[model samples]
Target: MTKKVRSVRPDTSFKETALALIQNRLSGVPVVDRQGRLVGIVSESDLLPREALDDDLLASAQAFFEGTFDWDSLFKNRKAVALTAGELMTTPVQTATPHTLLRQVAKRLSESGLRVLPVVDHGKVVGMVTRHDVLKVYCASDADTLCNVKDALEHRGYVPPRHCIDASVHEGIVTLGGTTIDPEGLRRALALVRAMDGVVAIRNLVRVDSSAG
Candidate 1:
Protein backbone atom coordinates (compact mmCIF):
# COMPACT_ATOMS: atom_id res chain seq x y z
CA MET A 1 0.00 0.00 0.00
CA THR A 2 1.19 3.53 -0.78
CA LYS A 3 1.45 5.54 2.41
CA LYS A 4 1.32 8.83 0.57
CA VAL A 5 -1.96 9.35 -1.28
CA ARG A 6 -3.25 12.12 -3.51
CA SER A 7 -6.73 13.27 -2.52
CA VAL A 8 -9.17 16.10 -2.92
CA ARG A 9 -11.77 17.81 -0.78
CA PRO A 10 -15.49 17.48 -1.33
CA ASP A 11 -16.00 21.18 -2.05
CA THR A 12 -13.18 21.29 -4.61
CA SER A 13 -14.35 22.32 -8.08
CA PHE A 14 -14.46 19.83 -10.93
CA LYS A 15 -11.93 21.84 -12.90
CA GLU A 16 -9.55 21.77 -9.94
CA THR A 17 -10.08 18.06 -9.43
CA ALA A 18 -9.44 17.40 -13.12
CA LEU A 19 -6.30 19.50 -12.96
CA ALA A 20 -5.17 17.64 -9.86
CA LEU A 21 -5.69 14.31 -11.61
CA ILE A 22 -3.70 15.54 -14.61
CA GLN A 23 -0.87 16.98 -12.53
CA ASN A 24 -0.65 13.89 -10.37
CA ARG A 25 -1.04 11.56 -13.37
CA LEU A 26 -3.80 9.67 -11.57
CA SER A 27 -7.05 8.37 -13.01
CA GLY A 28 -8.94 9.18 -9.80
CA VAL A 29 -8.54 10.57 -6.30
CA PRO A 30 -10.35 10.03 -3.04
CA VAL A 31 -12.58 12.79 -1.73
CA VAL A 32 -11.89 13.66 1.86
CA ASP A 33 -13.16 16.00 4.52
CA ARG A 34 -11.07 18.59 6.40
CA GLN A 35 -10.38 15.84 8.96
CA GLY A 36 -8.98 13.65 6.13
CA ARG A 37 -11.71 11.03 6.31
CA LEU A 38 -12.51 9.45 2.97
CA VAL A 39 -16.03 10.27 1.82
CA GLY A 40 -15.98 9.36 -1.86
CA ILE A 41 -13.90 9.23 -5.04
CA VAL A 42 -13.93 11.07 -8.36
CA SER A 43 -12.52 9.70 -11.59
CA GLU A 44 -11.75 10.76 -15.16
CA SER A 45 -14.62 8.56 -16.35
CA ASP A 46 -16.95 10.57 -14.15
CA LEU A 47 -15.85 13.81 -15.79
CA LEU A 48 -15.04 12.73 -19.34
CA PRO A 49 -18.62 12.22 -20.49
CA ARG A 50 -19.55 15.73 -19.40
CA GLU A 51 -16.33 17.27 -20.63
CA ALA A 52 -16.70 15.54 -24.00
CA LEU A 53 -19.80 17.59 -24.77
CA ASP A 54 -17.59 20.67 -25.10
CA ASP A 55 -14.83 18.99 -27.13
CA ASP A 56 -14.14 19.81 -30.80
CA LEU A 57 -14.32 16.09 -31.59
CA LEU A 58 -17.86 15.92 -30.26
CA ALA A 59 -18.76 19.05 -32.22
CA SER A 60 -17.36 17.54 -35.42
CA ALA A 61 -19.24 14.30 -34.84
CA GLN A 62 -22.44 16.19 -34.17
CA ALA A 63 -21.89 18.34 -37.26
CA PHE A 64 -21.44 15.22 -39.38
CA PHE A 65 -24.79 13.82 -38.19
CA GLU A 66 -26.85 17.06 -38.01
CA GLY A 67 -27.06 20.07 -40.30
CA THR A 68 -26.70 22.47 -37.36
CA PHE A 69 -25.34 22.49 -33.80
CA ASP A 70 -27.48 23.74 -30.87
CA TRP A 71 -24.78 25.72 -29.08
CA ASP A 72 -27.22 27.40 -26.62
CA SER A 73 -28.77 24.10 -25.50
CA LEU A 74 -25.39 22.45 -25.16
CA PHE A 75 -24.14 25.30 -23.01
CA LYS A 76 -27.28 25.15 -20.87
CA ASN A 77 -26.89 21.44 -20.11
CA ARG A 78 -26.16 20.91 -16.41
CA LYS A 79 -23.61 18.18 -17.16
CA ALA A 80 -21.64 20.58 -19.37
CA VAL A 81 -21.22 22.98 -16.45
CA ALA A 82 -18.32 22.54 -14.05
CA LEU A 83 -19.48 20.95 -10.78
CA THR A 84 -17.88 20.20 -7.43
CA ALA A 85 -16.28 16.99 -6.26
CA GLY A 86 -19.19 16.47 -3.88
CA GLU A 87 -21.52 16.46 -6.86
CA LEU A 88 -19.44 14.16 -9.01
CA MET A 89 -17.78 11.71 -6.66
CA THR A 90 -19.20 8.23 -6.02
CA THR A 91 -20.05 7.57 -2.39
CA PRO A 92 -20.09 4.54 -0.09
CA VAL A 93 -16.64 3.76 -1.39
CA GLN A 94 -15.10 0.31 -0.95
CA THR A 95 -12.04 0.20 1.30
CA ALA A 96 -9.54 -2.17 2.88
CA THR A 97 -8.03 -2.31 6.32
CA PRO A 98 -4.31 -2.49 7.07
CA HIS A 99 -4.70 -6.04 8.42
CA THR A 100 -6.66 -7.24 5.39
CA LEU A 101 -5.04 -10.31 3.82
CA LEU A 102 -3.35 -9.85 0.44
CA ARG A 103 -5.55 -12.51 -1.18
CA GLN A 104 -8.70 -10.77 0.05
CA VAL A 105 -7.46 -7.42 -1.19
CA ALA A 106 -6.77 -8.92 -4.59
CA LYS A 107 -10.22 -10.49 -4.65
CA ARG A 108 -11.97 -7.22 -3.81
CA LEU A 109 -10.06 -5.30 -6.46
CA SER A 110 -10.81 -7.95 -9.07
CA GLU A 111 -14.53 -8.15 -8.20
CA SER A 112 -15.02 -4.40 -7.99
CA GLY A 113 -12.95 -3.37 -10.99
CA LEU A 114 -11.27 -0.70 -8.87
CA ARG A 115 -7.70 0.32 -9.53
CA VAL A 116 -7.19 1.75 -6.04
CA LEU A 117 -8.53 0.99 -2.58
CA PRO A 118 -8.16 3.31 0.37
CA VAL A 119 -6.72 1.59 3.41
CA VAL A 120 -8.56 2.69 6.48
CA ASP A 121 -7.92 2.32 10.19
CA HIS A 122 -10.25 3.48 12.95
CA GLY A 123 -12.55 4.93 10.27
CA LYS A 124 -9.85 7.17 8.80
CA VAL A 125 -7.89 6.81 5.61
CA VAL A 126 -4.31 5.72 6.28
CA GLY A 127 -2.99 4.72 2.85
CA MET A 128 -3.96 3.51 -0.59
CA VAL A 129 -3.59 0.04 -2.15
CA THR A 130 -3.49 -0.41 -5.90
CA ARG A 131 -3.72 -3.47 -8.11
CA HIS A 132 -0.02 -3.03 -8.83
CA ASP A 133 0.77 -3.24 -5.12
CA VAL A 134 -1.13 -6.53 -4.83
CA LEU A 135 0.38 -7.82 -8.07
CA LYS A 136 3.88 -7.39 -6.70
CA VAL A 137 3.18 -9.97 -4.03
CA TYR A 138 1.77 -12.47 -6.53
CA CYS A 139 4.75 -11.97 -8.82
CA ALA A 140 7.35 -12.87 -6.22
CA SER A 141 9.36 -15.98 -7.10
CA ASP A 142 8.97 -19.13 -5.01
CA ALA A 143 12.72 -19.21 -4.35
CA ASP A 144 12.62 -15.67 -3.04
CA THR A 145 9.74 -16.50 -0.71
CA LEU A 146 11.52 -19.56 0.68
CA CYS A 147 14.76 -17.64 1.18
CA ASN A 148 12.93 -14.89 3.02
CA VAL A 149 11.19 -17.39 5.30
CA LYS A 150 14.47 -19.09 6.16
CA ASP A 151 16.14 -15.74 6.75
CA ALA A 152 13.33 -14.63 9.03
CA LEU A 153 13.57 -17.85 11.10
CA GLU A 154 17.34 -17.51 11.39
CA HIS A 155 17.00 -13.90 12.42
CA ARG A 156 14.66 -15.02 15.20
CA GLY A 157 17.29 -17.56 16.35
CA TYR A 158 15.29 -20.60 15.21
CA VAL A 159 18.31 -22.46 13.82
CA PRO A 160 19.71 -26.00 13.75
CA PRO A 161 20.52 -28.11 16.90
CA ARG A 162 18.39 -25.85 19.11
CA HIS A 163 15.41 -25.24 16.84
CA CYS A 164 15.44 -27.02 13.52
CA ILE A 165 13.04 -25.67 10.86
CA ASP A 166 13.46 -26.65 7.23
CA ALA A 167 11.34 -24.96 4.57
CA SER A 168 10.49 -26.00 1.03
CA VAL A 169 8.50 -23.89 -1.43
CA HIS A 170 6.52 -25.29 -4.33
CA GLU A 171 4.40 -22.88 -6.34
CA GLY A 172 4.38 -20.43 -3.42
CA ILE A 173 3.14 -22.95 -0.83
CA VAL A 174 5.68 -23.58 1.95
CA THR A 175 6.09 -26.92 3.68
CA LEU A 176 7.91 -26.62 6.99
CA GLY A 177 9.46 -29.87 8.24
CA GLY A 178 11.81 -30.74 11.08
CA THR A 179 11.92 -30.71 14.89
CA THR A 180 11.74 -27.69 17.18
CA ILE A 181 12.83 -27.82 20.83
CA ASP A 182 10.94 -24.60 21.50
CA PRO A 183 7.23 -24.41 20.66
CA GLU A 184 7.34 -20.59 20.86
CA GLY A 185 10.12 -20.51 18.25
CA LEU A 186 8.11 -22.85 16.04
CA ARG A 187 5.04 -20.62 16.37
CA ARG A 188 7.05 -17.54 15.52
CA ALA A 189 8.59 -19.26 12.51
CA LEU A 190 5.19 -20.34 11.24
CA ALA A 191 3.79 -16.84 11.75
CA LEU A 192 6.70 -15.31 9.87
CA VAL A 193 6.26 -17.64 6.91
CA ARG A 194 2.50 -17.18 6.88
CA ALA A 195 2.87 -13.42 6.76
CA MET A 196 5.39 -13.50 3.94
CA ASP A 197 4.41 -12.22 0.50
CA GLY A 198 3.64 -14.91 -2.16
CA VAL A 199 3.11 -17.60 0.48
CA VAL A 200 -0.23 -19.07 -0.51
CA ALA A 201 -0.36 -21.56 2.37
CA ILE A 202 1.77 -23.45 4.90
CA ARG A 203 2.08 -27.15 5.71
CA ASN A 204 3.46 -27.72 9.20
CA LEU A 205 5.14 -31.10 9.48
CA VAL A 206 7.38 -30.09 12.37
CA ARG A 207 7.21 -32.24 15.50
CA VAL A 208 7.38 -30.14 18.65
CA ASP A 209 9.69 -31.41 21.45
CA SER A 210 8.30 -30.08 24.71
CA SER A 211 11.05 -31.77 26.81
CA ALA A 212 13.89 -29.63 25.43
CA GLY A 213 14.12 -26.01 26.54
Candidate 2:
Protein backbone atom coordinates (compact mmCIF):
# COMPACT_ATOMS: atom_id res chain seq x y z
CA MET A 1 0.00 0.00 0.00
CA THR A 2 1.23 3.50 -0.82
CA LYS A 3 1.28 6.07 1.96
CA LYS A 4 0.64 9.06 -0.26
CA VAL A 5 -2.59 8.76 -2.26
CA ARG A 6 -3.08 11.13 -5.20
CA SER A 7 -6.63 12.24 -5.70
CA VAL A 8 -8.84 14.65 -7.63
CA ARG A 9 -11.69 16.84 -6.45
CA PRO A 10 -15.20 16.30 -7.84
CA ASP A 11 -15.19 19.64 -9.61
CA THR A 12 -11.80 18.99 -11.20
CA SER A 13 -11.97 19.43 -14.95
CA PHE A 14 -11.42 16.43 -17.21
CA LYS A 15 -8.33 18.09 -18.65
CA GLU A 16 -6.78 18.42 -15.21
CA THR A 17 -7.75 14.88 -14.33
CA ALA A 18 -6.18 13.53 -17.52
CA LEU A 19 -2.99 15.46 -16.76
CA ALA A 20 -2.90 14.02 -13.26
CA LEU A 21 -3.15 10.45 -14.53
CA ILE A 22 -0.57 11.03 -17.25
CA GLN A 23 1.93 12.96 -15.11
CA ASN A 24 1.70 10.46 -12.28
CA ARG A 25 1.66 7.41 -14.56
CA LEU A 26 -1.42 6.21 -12.76
CA SER A 27 -4.33 4.30 -14.28
CA GLY A 28 -6.85 5.78 -11.88
CA VAL A 29 -7.47 8.50 -9.31
CA PRO A 30 -9.93 8.68 -6.46
CA VAL A 31 -12.39 11.52 -6.30
CA VAL A 32 -12.83 13.17 -2.92
CA ASP A 33 -15.37 15.68 -1.68
CA ARG A 34 -14.62 18.94 0.12
CA GLN A 35 -14.85 17.03 3.40
CA GLY A 36 -12.32 14.48 2.15
CA ARG A 37 -14.90 11.77 1.63
CA LEU A 38 -14.42 9.40 -1.26
CA VAL A 39 -17.29 10.06 -3.62
CA GLY A 40 -16.17 8.24 -6.76
CA ILE A 41 -13.22 7.10 -8.82
CA VAL A 42 -11.94 7.91 -12.33
CA SER A 43 -10.01 5.41 -14.39
CA GLU A 44 -8.55 5.34 -17.89
CA SER A 45 -11.36 2.99 -18.88
CA ASP A 46 -13.89 5.59 -17.80
CA LEU A 47 -12.32 8.13 -20.09
CA LEU A 48 -12.05 5.90 -23.15
CA PRO A 49 -15.70 5.95 -24.21
CA ARG A 50 -15.31 9.29 -25.96
CA GLU A 51 -12.71 8.90 -28.70
CA ALA A 52 -11.01 11.45 -30.91
CA LEU A 53 -11.88 12.26 -34.53
CA ASP A 54 -10.49 9.67 -36.89
CA ASP A 55 -10.09 12.38 -39.52
CA ASP A 56 -7.48 14.09 -37.32
CA LEU A 57 -5.41 10.90 -37.30
CA LEU A 58 -5.82 10.43 -41.05
CA ALA A 59 -4.54 13.98 -41.63
CA SER A 60 -1.44 13.58 -39.50
CA ALA A 61 0.90 13.86 -42.53
CA GLN A 62 -0.86 16.92 -43.87
CA ALA A 63 -0.94 18.55 -40.43
CA PHE A 64 2.77 17.87 -39.97
CA PHE A 65 3.67 19.41 -43.36
CA GLU A 66 1.42 22.41 -42.72
CA GLY A 67 2.66 22.79 -39.11
CA THR A 68 -0.99 22.87 -37.99
CA PHE A 69 -0.86 20.05 -35.42
CA ASP A 70 -2.71 21.19 -32.29
CA TRP A 71 -2.23 18.30 -29.93
CA ASP A 72 -3.88 20.16 -27.04
CA SER A 73 -7.07 20.69 -29.01
CA LEU A 74 -7.06 17.23 -30.54
CA PHE A 75 -6.62 15.49 -27.18
CA LYS A 76 -9.20 17.73 -25.58
CA ASN A 77 -11.76 16.52 -28.10
CA ARG A 78 -10.66 12.94 -27.41
CA LYS A 79 -11.26 13.15 -23.68
CA ALA A 80 -14.37 11.77 -22.08
CA VAL A 81 -17.59 13.61 -22.91
CA ALA A 82 -18.24 14.47 -19.25
CA LEU A 83 -16.31 17.66 -18.50
CA THR A 84 -15.88 17.22 -14.73
CA ALA A 85 -14.44 14.46 -12.60
CA GLY A 86 -17.74 14.11 -10.78
CA GLU A 87 -19.58 13.44 -14.02
CA LEU A 88 -17.04 10.98 -15.38
CA MET A 89 -16.17 9.17 -12.17
CA THR A 90 -17.65 5.80 -11.26
CA THR A 91 -19.62 5.73 -8.01
CA PRO A 92 -19.67 3.02 -5.35
CA VAL A 93 -15.96 2.73 -5.83
CA GLN A 94 -14.16 -0.41 -4.78
CA THR A 95 -11.78 0.26 -1.91
CA ALA A 96 -9.73 -1.26 0.87
CA THR A 97 -8.96 -0.14 4.39
CA PRO A 98 -5.71 0.04 6.35
CA HIS A 99 -6.82 -3.05 8.22
CA THR A 100 -7.79 -5.02 5.09
CA LEU A 101 -5.73 -8.13 4.68
CA LEU A 102 -3.27 -8.30 1.82
CA ARG A 103 -4.88 -11.46 0.49
CA GLN A 104 -8.26 -9.78 0.49
CA VAL A 105 -6.87 -6.80 -1.36
CA ALA A 106 -5.28 -9.13 -3.89
CA LYS A 107 -8.52 -11.00 -4.34
CA ARG A 108 -10.45 -7.77 -4.85
CA LEU A 109 -7.96 -6.49 -7.34
CA SER A 110 -8.03 -9.75 -9.22
CA GLU A 111 -11.77 -10.35 -9.31
CA SER A 112 -12.90 -6.74 -9.44
CA GLY A 113 -10.58 -5.86 -12.35
CA LEU A 114 -9.17 -2.83 -10.60
CA ARG A 115 -5.68 -1.60 -11.37
CA VAL A 116 -5.51 0.56 -8.27
CA LEU A 117 -7.68 0.29 -5.18
CA PRO A 118 -7.94 3.17 -2.78
CA VAL A 119 -7.24 2.51 0.88
CA VAL A 120 -9.73 4.51 2.88
CA ASP A 121 -10.29 5.41 6.48
CA HIS A 122 -13.91 6.24 7.28
CA GLY A 123 -14.60 7.06 3.65
CA LYS A 124 -11.54 9.33 3.36
CA VAL A 125 -8.65 8.21 1.19
CA VAL A 126 -5.46 7.71 3.18
CA GLY A 127 -3.53 5.54 0.77
CA MET A 128 -3.74 3.28 -2.25
CA VAL A 129 -2.68 -0.22 -3.29
CA THR A 130 -1.83 -1.36 -6.80
CA ARG A 131 -1.62 -4.81 -8.39
CA HIS A 132 2.12 -4.37 -8.72
CA ASP A 133 2.35 -3.95 -4.97
CA VAL A 134 0.70 -7.33 -4.33
CA LEU A 135 2.80 -9.02 -6.97
CA LYS A 136 6.00 -7.91 -5.28
CA VAL A 137 5.03 -9.78 -2.11
CA TYR A 138 3.75 -13.00 -3.70
CA CYS A 139 6.27 -13.36 -6.52
CA ALA A 140 9.24 -14.55 -4.44
CA SER A 141 11.01 -17.59 -5.80
CA ASP A 142 10.81 -21.02 -4.16
CA ALA A 143 14.49 -20.86 -3.24
CA ASP A 144 13.93 -17.58 -1.46
CA THR A 145 11.06 -19.09 0.50
CA LEU A 146 13.18 -22.04 1.58
CA CYS A 147 16.02 -19.78 2.63
CA ASN A 148 13.61 -17.61 4.58
CA VAL A 149 12.17 -20.64 6.38
CA LYS A 150 15.59 -21.90 7.38
CA ASP A 151 16.56 -18.46 8.61
CA ALA A 152 13.40 -18.26 10.69
CA LEU A 153 14.16 -21.54 12.40
CA GLU A 154 17.76 -20.58 13.04
CA HIS A 155 16.75 -17.23 14.58
CA ARG A 156 14.42 -19.04 17.03
CA GLY A 157 17.36 -21.09 18.40
CA TYR A 158 15.85 -24.52 18.02
CA VAL A 159 16.72 -26.62 21.07
CA PRO A 160 17.38 -30.06 19.50
CA PRO A 161 19.35 -28.41 16.64
CA ARG A 162 18.39 -28.10 12.95
CA HIS A 163 20.08 -31.34 11.82
CA CYS A 164 17.11 -33.42 13.01
CA ILE A 165 14.73 -31.30 10.96
CA ASP A 166 14.13 -32.27 7.34
CA ALA A 167 12.75 -29.43 5.28
CA SER A 168 12.44 -29.04 1.51
CA VAL A 169 10.53 -26.60 -0.64
CA HIS A 170 8.97 -27.21 -4.10
CA GLU A 171 6.69 -24.88 -5.94
CA GLY A 172 6.10 -22.91 -2.76
CA ILE A 173 5.08 -26.08 -0.88
CA VAL A 174 7.08 -26.82 2.27
CA THR A 175 7.52 -30.40 3.43
CA LEU A 176 8.40 -30.88 7.12
CA GLY A 177 9.72 -34.24 8.31
CA GLY A 178 11.24 -34.76 11.71
CA THR A 179 10.55 -36.13 15.19
CA THR A 180 9.53 -33.75 17.94
CA ILE A 181 8.27 -34.70 21.40
CA ASP A 182 6.96 -31.16 21.94
CA PRO A 183 3.68 -30.54 20.10
CA GLU A 184 4.05 -26.85 20.92
CA GLY A 185 7.30 -26.67 19.02
CA LEU A 186 5.78 -28.35 16.00
CA ARG A 187 2.81 -25.99 16.13
CA ARG A 188 5.07 -22.95 16.39
CA ALA A 189 7.22 -24.08 13.46
CA LEU A 190 4.22 -24.76 11.28
CA ALA A 191 2.67 -21.42 12.11
CA LEU A 192 5.92 -19.62 11.37
CA VAL A 193 6.25 -21.19 7.93
CA ARG A 194 2.58 -20.74 7.10
CA ALA A 195 2.81 -17.01 7.77
CA MET A 196 5.85 -16.63 5.53
CA ASP A 197 5.54 -15.10 2.07
CA GLY A 198 5.31 -17.40 -1.00
CA VAL A 199 4.52 -20.47 1.09
CA VAL A 200 1.52 -22.01 -0.62
CA ALA A 201 1.11 -25.28 1.30
CA ILE A 202 2.78 -27.34 4.02
CA ARG A 203 3.16 -31.12 4.32
CA ASN A 204 3.62 -31.70 8.04
CA LEU A 205 5.12 -35.18 8.51
CA VAL A 206 6.54 -34.29 11.89
CA ARG A 207 5.62 -36.91 14.49
CA VAL A 208 5.13 -36.26 18.19
CA ASP A 209 6.86 -39.35 19.62
CA SER A 210 9.01 -39.45 22.74
CA SER A 211 11.06 -42.47 21.59
CA ALA A 212 12.01 -40.83 18.26
CA GLY A 213 14.88 -38.37 17.87
- Candidate 2: list runs displaced more than 4 Å: 52-80, 139-171, 179-196, 207-213
RMSD of each: 7.4, 8.9
Q: Report, for every candidate in turn, its global Cα lDDT versus the true structure.
A: 0.79, 0.79
Give the TM-score (vs. native) of candidate 1: 0.61
Candidate 2 residues 122-183, lDDT tens each?
Answer: 87899878988877865788889888888887786432474355678988898988777777
Which residues of candidate 1, in runs, are more than 4 Å off? 54-82, 148-167, 170-196, 200-213
Model 2 weakest 10-residue run by lDDT: 157-166
Per-residue accuracy of model 1 over 61-101 as CA lDDT, tens digit each: 67758878666655445444548888777778888999998
lDDT of 2 at 121: 92
What TM-score does model 2 achieve against the real structure?
0.65
In terms of TM-score, which candidate is strongest? 2
Clashes of 2: 0
